[model samples]
Target: MEELIKRVEELEKNTQKSSRERELLLNRICELEDLVEDLTLQLKKSKKTIRTPVAPKESLAINNASKKTNAQEDEPWLFYCPKNKPYEEILRNLDFSEGYEITSSALVSEEALWTQILEKMNEEEIPKKLTALRKLVSVQLSSACHHELLIIVRGIPGNENPLFQLILPHIATLAEYVNIAWSEVENSNPELLGRIALVLECEQDLKVLSVDRGDTRLSLYVEKLL
Candidate 1:
């Protein structure tokens, strides 16, 4: 009976040892699972970090250029008639750069001239086909038949008010252009022709230009004649 009791006690110890061994094995498996999960997360992060390929410098430049092109396309008007507005004093000013043009060729009334401009805008596919009147200051309209006070005009694109782009800082340059153009309207004397401006004042948000003489300051205004 004593031996049997001793045997029973040994069996209990063996069973306890087996239970501990099983617990250890289960704990080890949980640890391995956790390690694998962590490694998988780290791997996913590394993949994300390297996912985006570095663009080449040339490619970046091209993309930027394309963006600029799109922007310019949306706005068909060209920049700084600065090159030509100065053309007034210089008689050779007739030599217009590419993409610039004299809106009216024949002697047309002011109202007619405006109509011609709109017609031109409608005819031309802006941006792709850039076209606008060349900045002509000294426009000669006096003729032998009837010098019925023929004249021309000049002004800034947008100064205090912007026609399209932000007002530029080059006021002096604009002034020079205005003075030359307005001079054609008048002489050293004050101009009878009223200064003009382009504005978005009304619901139409009309566009026009203005010129100041003496100082030759230039600015934009609104003309709702359209």
Candidate 2:
């Protein structure tokens, strides 16, 4: 009988030990699962951080090149026309009937001048087109007036002085972009002259050339780009 009792006690102790070991194994398994979850989260976060920088770096490189190219383009020679009365409307109504005969030696036909101006205006860039247009006008005016062809500005003064000098490398840089100039535009639209006046009034950097500041406010000239 004592042997049987001893056997029963030993069996109970073994069962208790087995139970404890099973509980410990379960706790360890739980700990391992938690560790796996934490590792997975960390990996996802690391992947996100790694991917963030590459895209911006390429974008920055491209932007720098574009900016550099833009910086190299030519700037316009701004000239201030001094006149008590704004000649914006008058300039628009100029009849090229007399033709460009400002010089005694030669005469330039209006059709020839118009053809040249139109060719120059046929540019992809709006600023280049405008610059070309301004140049053409300057050429015609210089020829018509019998003066050394210089930069020209014909516009009415605005009510308020310009606060900031806007240097538009392209017409795209302007507040408004108008792809409205061509041979037809010059022929029918007298407002074309007013368009230039509008640009002068709106943008800055039209540098006034050192020309004769006379009573006649018909045109303004500069010896060279200041």
Clashing pairs in 2: 78-206, 78-207, 79-207, 80-208
Q: What is the per-residue lDDT of model 1 for residues 137-164, given as tens digits with 9 covering 90 to 100?
A: 1122211001122112223233333432
Tens digit per residue, CA lDDT, model 2, 1-226: 9999999999999987975675465556556766898999998888745444442221111111111111243222222334322344324333112211111011133333333333333422121233333444444432322211121222323335331212221211111111122212334542333222112322223333111213322222211211
**Prediction 2 global C-alpha lDDT:** 0.31
Off by over 4 Å in 1: 49-226
TM-score per prediction, in order, is: 0.22, 0.22
Best by lDDT: 1
Q: What is the C-alpha lDDT of each candidate?
A: 0.32, 0.31
Candidate 1: lDDT over CA atoms? Answer: 0.32
The Cα error of candidate 1 at residue 164, in Å, is 62
Model 1 TM-score on a 0 to 1 scale? 0.22
